[model samples]
Target: MTARVLLLGGTGDALAIARTLGPQHVYSLAGLGRVPADLACVVRVGGFGGAEGLARFLADEAVSLVFDATHPYAARISANAARACLAAQVPYWALRRAPWRAQAGDDWRMVSGWAGVVEAIAPFARPLFTLGREPLEHLNEVPEQQHWTVRCLEAHPGHARARIIDARGPFTAEGERALFTESRIDVVVSKNSGGAATEAKLAVARGMGLPVVMMQRPPLPDAQREFTSAQEVIGALDDYIKRSSNA
Candidate 1:
């Protein structure tokens, strides 16, 4: 029997990999989005409890390999995937996009994590937050005097000082420019989720000479192999299957 593959899904990279792998693989989403993307593979939504639950699921399903193409900032899920794959004795790989770097004319204040973001934006008012729904709670740490305009994939019950814009990405610089103008946004606060889908805002901020508080990506669990592109991951997965067959 052919080995079963499991893809920890959600990001554009995950969908691209699933499409390339066809319908034979299993794709799992965390169900955080209002509408999950349709994939060609077998789709599983919601979490598998935690690390223990994921290991049990992998055993029950006889999953031979796991591909983690989750969001860059999804530290907990990535950690769980690493632990579960190890416990289940399955081969695993992480597909991460290249991170964005500071460019000429970019006014970037690089910070390590969410706490750094809070501190970096302390004096700035009219902030545009693109850090997603999970970190919206942390906005409570910001002083009430600063008004925030948050843009995310889903609607979140944010602080009274925050105005939420529910939208998806593949955003363009022109559109982001309009948003920044309309919202009177003076600063942009975002995580370093590198990819073209949501990167236009950074360029727009830079063009407008707006200050950007960039939060660095969290550390990923050390995997045996890591890739930066969908094509590379596809090739690696094919090689992995070939090796499994020979074994």
Candidate 2:
């Protein structure tokens, strides 16, 4: 029988880790969303209700190991998973993606979180909020009735007079520059979603000599963790298995 693992999932790392442990370890994705392609093992959806619930599940399911592979922003789930794993005496591991870094000429105005962006952009003249549709209103809905250029995956009509840029990303540096230039953006607001998907905006802002109001990433629980790319995760799992066998 294959060794079973409780995978607290949601995000690229979880999917990658699941794919890496295929056939050898049973994976259970515990997020309230559709499972991504990299995760094909036996999956569970939604929250297990914090620590106690997860502890019960671990005991009932006979999970031998636990891996917190959720998004870095998922602080509660990471913490709950750690607590449950510790309570159940299961070995725990984490797969964390590295944070994004600022590049040259990146006119970055870093803030701590969404609230920080709200405070920063609320007063800025000619602000552009690319922090997604859900968060667009948080800053745009201020009493001043400010106008904003909101870029997102779909047409987001949530905010007041938002100049919507309906586009997806994997966007190149040049494309981002063009978007910002055409829009005549003065200040760019965004979340620190540490990935290439939406990071182009920072580069574009830099190229245009515009400063970006950047939100910080969420904190996560510390564990015996392995941080790497999608491909590297597979190698790490294989090495872990080999070492365990040798021991």
- Name the candidate that leads on TM-score: 1
lDDT of each: 0.86, 0.70
Model 2, runs deviating above 4 Å: 23-34, 37-39, 130-140, 143-145, 149-157, 163-169, 241-247
lDDT of 2: 0.70
Q: State TM-scores per candidate.
A: 0.90, 0.78
Encode model 2's per-residue lDDT on 144-187: one tens digit a residue.
55666777655655545556767656678888777667766778
lDDT of 1 by residue, 1-247 (tens): 5767899988877887787665667989898774345666788889999999999999998898888999999999999999999999987789888999999999999999777887888888889988888457766765767888988888777677878889888998989999999989998988898988999998999889999998888999987789998889988887777777687
Best by lDDT: 1
Candidate 2, after superposition: displacement of residue 170 in Å? 2.7
